[model samples]
Target chain A: MITSGDHMNWKDNLIKIAPYVAGEQPDKRDFIKLNANENPYPPAPGVIKAIEDFRGADLKKYPDANARPLMKAIAEDLGVDADNVFVGNGSDDVLALSFRAFFNSDKPIVFPDITYSFYPVWCEMLGIPYRTLPVGEDFNINAGDYNCENGGVVIANPNAPTGIGRDLSFMREILDANPGSVVISDEAYVDFGGVSALPLLREYDNLIVIRTFSKSRSMAGMRIGFAVGGDTLISALRAAKDSYNSYPLDSVAIAAGCASVADRAYFESTLKKVMATRDRLTAELRAMGFEVPDSSTNFLFAHHKSRKAADIYDFLKSRDIYVRHFRKPERISDHLRITIGTDEETDRLTAALHEYLG
Target chain B: MITSGDHMNWKDNLIKIAPYVAGEQPDKRDFIKLNANENPYPPAPGVIKAIEDFRGADLKKYPDANARPLMKAIAEDLGVDADNVFVGNGSDDVLALSFRAFFNSDKPIVFPDITYSFYPVWCEMLGIPYRTLPVGEDFNINAGDYNCENGGVVIANPNAPTGIGRDLSFMREILDANPGSVVISDEAYVDFGGVSALPLLREYDNLIVIRTFSKSRSMAGMRIGFAVGGDTLISALRAAKDSYNSYPLDSVAIAAGCASVADRAYFESTLKKVMATRDRLTAELRAMGFEVPDSSTNFLFAHHKSRKAADIYDFLKSRDIYVRHFRKPERISDHLRITIGTDEETDRLTAALHEYLG
Candidate 1:
């Protein structure tokens, strides 16, 4: 009898690193699922129609290798040439490809210590050395910290967990400082009042602005994301993507993504609603003695003045509400990242908070 | 003016290799599309129903990171526990992750020279060294060639382009020889009358049998694929997948894939039709003075007695037909890989070939 271990220590030599632990996804829908920063609203009306009208027979063929129609729509939406776009399964896929495409020098790539946890995971997966500069005391990325020499730079514009947005000027400063390295502005949450570095592509050839349909477009389940960059950088990313997985986007995703991008009015309306809810939620949390950041995303990162974040998270979970609370890095261990739910859901959440705090 | 090249030769350090060129995905429906080896029939009836019944609102939330329902369905269909199954965006993604997961040692990995082109592309992308051993004049994998020391092994059963299937004994011989390395049997075309390595899983803990919906299940546009192996190997693949893209399989893909697997009758029926078309096409090609291989897959690999493969490919294209003709690796450059289409499509293709040959 041969145990799996009887084989060579394949796990030791294999790229065995800890995988990124995604937010808890409880099966039952009864919970106010604020854990994953998912959009509260459904996808655009056109997107729903596209899904409904999708031909079942079309699925027999492979999806467009170039994801051409979807690329055209995203290009039009971003006011960029289709040649400047690269689409993938999600921003994670896009970012992974970008890491492989641009970050290759012996120098360590740099990103914020407290940004999206997946950044370091990608770096580790690709065997790229990386250094994490700490964010400011306010939990915002210090642009000056990224001016140093590196293989590349990845910044989550409106950085995750902190819900803080950075200006185009900040992005420009980083790009200007690191002309030798590729700069990726992960604008996953940019649609929710966050300024995108997309317009800066004209000035910065090294900049790649990555966006996703998961949050603002309300199509997380469809798994669509893209990067808008200079034609050269986009070409490089495409080469890497092709080498990895030629058809990352499926037919359903491509069709629904096209419809979602085309319905600009619906996209904006949902973004506005989510922003309004987030603002309201921020004020309510502050009134309850929580120090909530001025969120540029649909979620608020807050720490209570008196109550513990872990306790609040536990209480919320017990009350059938699910908000994220990271215990790592210690600095933000007391903070709770609460995704903004619908107005009614917010009301229920506030009521529950009142019961716990009062 | 900073030219795109002025800043840095990021391309030099970054992964820059010729990407695997996928078969032509022509847009117009007028052509009798036979390239890319995609299924000629539509996805299963249950898959169509699942797509129709799919809820657009669910796109707001992320897909189940574990792909629980899809995993369960595939596991049940393969008569394996859920722990033995790992799902991904496609077999390309699965194979990519598997390469990163298993083929990591300094020793070079091994595969057949005339096998799937993407295997070497993946090795290049992952920075893994690999050597290709030549298949016999029969174009069948010689399992004896894989018994030596190596990092890992990857075999495409009913191997691509050639469409020749090896029996379980062939697989057993390779597995028995390579207890120290992770052996991957990419059974992408196995459902089309090819013997699966899945049964060998109980006997060989080091073996992984990768399967895809693109070929046999007729869901190429859905981008669904899985691997059945020992629990430990599946866990490693899942870890690698999570590290790369936590949600590689989207919600729609998961739901549709489950439905496709549930309808066993439809799955078997499509396979039978494709196999029948393939058999008929082989006989017809042989009669037309083409030397064709005995194919267990939904495609036929054939070379004309006198005409050049490139010329045949061009002639077929002129008649609004598409067949794959590889230019590189000179051994098979004279052969064309033709996918099995519907009976009507096949008749048209044969008629067009007759015109070209006669």
Candidate 2:
């Protein structure tokens, strides 16, 4: 019995895969984790109740692979029909399926170099050739760069790491520039501040707007994500998902996701609270002589430029307050991505930074 | 807004994709659904209670993408190390990932021509060309036929559509013959009657045993599936899953699954009852002059050469007693895949069949 974790032959590229390293979840009591950009608020009370009372034995069977009920709920909330919706395990799953379903094998896909890190990962994993266009000095996407040969397009609204968003005017410009490409608007943070691309789905089958339950709905552990688009695009994603994992979500997930979405009042209130915290935290960080981006998401990307990011990271880690700092893209080396905690946690974070700076 | 779903180029193969259609989930008073093979038993009472009592903010955070906690629970139950295990949304997801990770890109993957309908569907969707190995006159898988050029091997124990299962000696022979290929043993029906291939994992790194909560555990609505193997094979699956959906199960689902697994007494009793019913129903079907397969799963496959499977399916549906009928391979055209219902529901099916035969 020669024990092994890797079996048989594998593709050469699979060997080089540096899979995304999720935040470490230590079992210590003193830790305050701001590593993953997860929502601070719990799911709406209705969602909790639904899970507790969900007595459907049919769940002992496979879930509706089509996720018809969740889609209906999402569509109704977004004021669209079921035909325009597709759902998955998370926004990441939807993005991966979309990449496989729509990206051309011949032409390379295009995305901003500083956008979501997962974009390149998807292209590589799917064997879709792709290129990363550099963001402008203002950290804005250059639509002209993707005017040439293309496969698919991905724009992370309120892009990760930088917290810079691409608004609708620029989004429409890119959609126009790449007439032949599938444009995916990843609105993982849109509800935080940016406008949605869902309304544009009526005009473009190529436009895919991806959203997640992790942020506004405060159900990251529930693992639900959705996409809104024209029928053709939705069909392709549907085909890929069905071919892959028929029941991506179990019965409890769908029940809770539907309940969370239906509680519009809770979602609205949660969103407002997060936005208020984000505004306060951004000002506080700047007051301590740090350069922080005006964030649209629940997190801020900040740097002192004078202070080494690693030193600050070490200082925070010693205090059991964990934030994210990646050693990638040399240009962003000085920055730290901090998820905005509640008012009390933020106050604690600012006080710690004040001591560290002194 | 020049929106189009079709304009974004897809792989030439993606357009030709026709996903497998699961049975209907009608939004009425839940009928005694005998379409998909699911356990009639509800999950452990503790499982329901745990889900109901979940008042944690875990839902607001991301799940452990690696599913470390669930893996530990499964490993502890199986007496295997956590490293030698993997889990996903359902067994179907694990099967799909295995096809790409363990199977070769060059040769045809082998399975029974009359086995689980999803086998060929997966092959077609992944563009992994496959050659169907026809089952014997007894509907038994011939281990000798697998000596040909092989990419990998997959077998649904107590094979779907026809519930007959293969013996351990024959499985050993198949695995020995194809030393280089990955052998996936889907033991979805094992607890019902068939023996598990889990013990074989120590002998072959290529052996992956897929199990589901849908059957014996009665948590199918919770959508949790697991695979047991040597560590290396597990790593490949983890890589594929991480690159796809980080969190396959939500917090409530995680809670439910764990609690269900913990209550061993409940599952043991449920299995005994289901097995007893299976034995009784098989004898009754045989006495009724219907040629029934010796089932090891929760379903029975029966046929009358004179009657078309479609006609029988329609006849049952008209009476609100539904069964699955596939028309692809001509051999099983006269057969119906019927799920084993509770005692009363089985009696109804038997009464309905008696009338149909009369």
Candidate 3:
């Protein structure tokens, strides 16, 4: 019998995973939540109607191993065939599968050190080694700095925490430099006015881009996530998914996701509201004397040397308003990651911050 | 820059993964799907109602990272603290997480040679080695055979394909023998009629039992699965889930799963109907000369050596009825996995088989 001993001793840089820390979810109610960068608005009416329309059959029956309808809708929206797309419980699920498909090399994976904290954790868990590139002094990625011989590059476009994003031109350049490596652009927050890399799918076969309905779509509770790439890349992800969990998305998720995706008008309108709110929120934070990064995503990363983010976070928590602050990675220590909520939610957050600063 | 080079150099035990083949989802028309064992009933009305209640909220919002409500409901049902349970996309997701938490070691993980095919796949993906313990000639696990020290033990109670289960006493004995390792009882089909090993939770902290909404609860379309174990074991899964995908179950899935669990009468009625259908179908198949196993699941595993499982599977498929068949693991090749369906659906399957056989 083959023992895990041989496999255990043959480790692949497993110790380096600094797991991603997300927002708190205490059972207590009445707390204002501005953590984990979730959108504060509810989903579209159509999405709700669809969920209401959801029918349960024998709970013993497995869901469509292939999320047929959900995949079809996504492909139609992306202008691709359903075969070119794969959906899962969350974009994080798809992203994890991507790590398995794209980063199974002796070389390392390159991404902004301060990017999504989940990237490194995926590397460690999948036994895939990774290399982190510190963002430039301005807290932006120096795309050229990812000069590795073997490993590909992954970047959360409009990156997380810092909330800085780059244009497609730089992404193309990054791909040009590492032609052999896979370039994955996780566009989780893309619909918030950032352009999608999906247009470039035809340009690079190694390019795999991931998108989620959580931010722009507001169906986070339904756990639907997907990826768009060359058929080969998508097939590889499909293989991993099939081997891992065939039916990751349930019926309610598929119904809601299809409804959410099809209601493009609602998606666009809600996104416009978020963008407008984000602009106002950023401006308000800046005027309050905090250094707010020009965010491309729906969330803001702000800090004030006058008051540490930790102290501000603590003060807000006392007032039932919650935001995000990280102590690790040594960079972005003063930063508080705050999600842009509704006007009312934003008001509550801004009002609470003002009191804390005072 | 740490590179994925180390992982690139890695060759997973691809050979060990006898890929799990879920039921075929044909696009032409929605036929009677008995391929993968899923509940035939829709979720309770309350489930859809809960989803509808939250439809107006933007689904783009990040889900509650901890899945507090769903976990709370699950804990209440299991009669344990919420901390003892962890919510997942499906039981498979929890099972995959278990591979990393309890079974990631140098020792060999052990399970029946012919059990859930996905078990070994998880081990292979995580680089955990395993020993395949053969079931006795009657096709059941003899717990005494697993005396060696290893990473852990995984058993799909009322094991799949065969759909036969061992009683709680045997499970307890095995848990006692493997005090140093985790013993996972995948009760995906347990709620149908199989006795739950859940009571053993008080007796053994080493035991982690997995459950799903896909069966018995009649919410396969909802894509919800959960795990209950010692708080320490649950914590390991929680840590992995946080680092991997913080919000696996979507809002609809969460709301639906909660409602399904809450609606005891609806759930019980559906299970009763499925159990009744399963019993009737089992007897009918035996009368027709198929060697049906004593099933505690919603499905039956049976076949005739002269009348091949694959041949019957194909015949049923042509007639728009589907069942699952495996090409690997020589032990069960002659067996066809048939999920008990609605009375009419079973009639259709048996009718198709009778026509094909005659």
Highest-DockQ candidate:
1
Q: Please give, for residues A191-296, the per-residue lDDT of candidate 1 as tens digits.
A: 8999999888898787888999999998899999899998778878888988888899999989999999888998889989999989988888889999988989
Winner on lDDT (1 vs 2): 1
Interface RMSD of predicted model 1:
3.0
Top candidate on lDDT is: 1
Query: Which residue runs does candidate 1 get wrong by more than 4 Å?
Result: A1-12, A19-22, A27-29, B1-6, B9-12, B19-22
| TM-score head-to-head 1 vs 3, winner | 1
How would you encode candidate 3's per-residue C-alpha lDDT over A109-174 as one tens digit per residue? 788888888888787777777888888888988878866665668888978878887898878877
Q: Backbone clashes per model, in order?
A: 0, 18, 60
Worst 10 residues of 2 chain A by lDDT: A6-15
i-RMS for every candidate: 3.0, 4.2, 6.2
User: Largest TM-score belongs to which candidate?
Assistant: 1
Candidate 2: which stretches are off by over 4 Å?
A1-20, A56-58, B1-15, B26-30
TM-score of chain B as predicted in candidate 1: 0.96
Query: lDDT rank, highest first?
Result: 1, 2, 3
Query: Ranking by DockQ, best first?
Result: 1, 2, 3
Q: Give candidate 3 regions above 4 Å deviation.
A: A1-22, A25-31, A58-61, A305-307, A347-358, B1-22, B27-31, B58-60, B351-358
| Better-scoring candidate (TM-score), 1 or 2 | 1
Measured against the true structure, the TM-scores of the candidates, in listed sequence, are 0.97, 0.95, 0.90
Calculate model 3's interface RMSD in Å: 6.2
